[model samples]
Target: MDWRLKRNCSMAPRQLLAFYLSLCILSLGIATMFWFQGARMIMTFAWIELFAVGLALWVVARHATDSESIVLRNDRLTVEVANGQQVERVEFQPAWVRVEPAHGDQSLIELSGQGRRIAVGRFVRPELRSQLAQELRHALRRWQQGAARPSPV
Candidate 1:
């Protein structure tokens, strides 16, 4: 069976804040070094840091509010939106699996079928984890039973 879905990614407010703060600290650190070194070298470093931060910010903002959570297909289980990268080609083979919402304050969906465990949505909100887990469980069952729809991909 082959399935393809587009997943969206969103980060928690605290996480976003932390990331921004980290970036700011990094920028400041570079600026401080420039200050001690005088004008020329520091100015160049500042521009580079600004460019890096701009790219990072753009990527984060663009994918942060995507509505799709996870895309599960025949040969791929892509988790979209972590640093704008996709985790794909996850095996959907059913092998004694348990699907559950992870314990803790985070909104995370964890899949443990056999000895393997993977965290699907560490960045998603807690309220959405159940639905995602249900979808995964259904998909896995279909795949395990050899009932999945055939895919060209």
Candidate 2:
């Protein structure tokens, strides 16, 4: 079984880029009109505003794909978290993994075993984080039970 969770992005990176391009064109066109009218400061301020907004949008686009994936296959449980440009992947034996909230019921879910720990469920709502933890625990339990059953020769 596998569970994949991702940020709910209203605008994709391509759509965001297109929107920024249109905004730049409109702003620059207006600034050019002001420059022809002898309001040179408007053009300068327009450039500054565009630069600031572009930087902010870039940051948003960078994290648009942030997500967490948990996979249970064979005897291993793998968790992968992607945040901005960094990705952290951890694997554990299903029998030894622990799933719980990091701080409280509304806090992020923590998975720990073998002296390693990582938090997940950041994209999930705080009210539903405990449910996510419970689902993970159930999946791990099922995996462990399946692993323990005997197979025909």
Candidate 3:
């Protein structure tokens, strides 16, 4: 079983870059017209505004692909989280892992075992976080049960 959770982005980073470029063209074109009319401050302020918007967009683009992936296969359970340029990966045996919320019910779900812990479900809604936790617990339970059973020779 595998569960992938990611942000609901309205636009990809490439699309965002295209939109920013178009905005720059339009704003700069209008600013140039105002500059020709002797309002040179318009061009200066346009450049400043575009710079601010570009910086904000760059921050957004950096985290556009942030995600959490949980995979249960065989006797191992793996959790991988990617945020901006950082990635964290953890593995545990299905029988030893514990699934619970880190804080309150609405907080992120945490998986802990063997002196290691990781939180997940950031992209999930607060109201539905419990449901996500429940699902993870159910999957882990099934894996544990399967691991406990003997295989036929």
Which numbered prediction scores highest in TM-score against the true structure? 2
lDDT of 3 by residue, 59-94 (tens): 999999999999988788899999999999999988
Candidate 1 similarity to native, TM-score: 0.43
Error of 2 at 134 (Å): 1.1
| Cα lDDT, model 1, residue 119 | 63
Off by over 4 Å in 3: 147-153
- What TM-score do all the candidates reach, one by one? 0.43, 0.94, 0.93
Note the clash tally of each candidate. 4, 0, 0
Q: Record all residue pairs in model 3 with backbone atoms less than 3 Å apart, i.e. clashing.
A: none
lDDT agreement with native, every candidate: 0.59, 0.92, 0.93
Question: What are the per-residue Cα lDDT tens digits for candidate 2 across 23-141?
Answer: 99999999999999999999999999999999999999999999999988777789999999999999998889999899999999999999999999999999999998998888777
What candidate 2 gets wrong by more than 4 Å, as runs, is 147-153
Model 2: number of backbone collisions:
0
Ranking by lDDT: 3, 2, 1
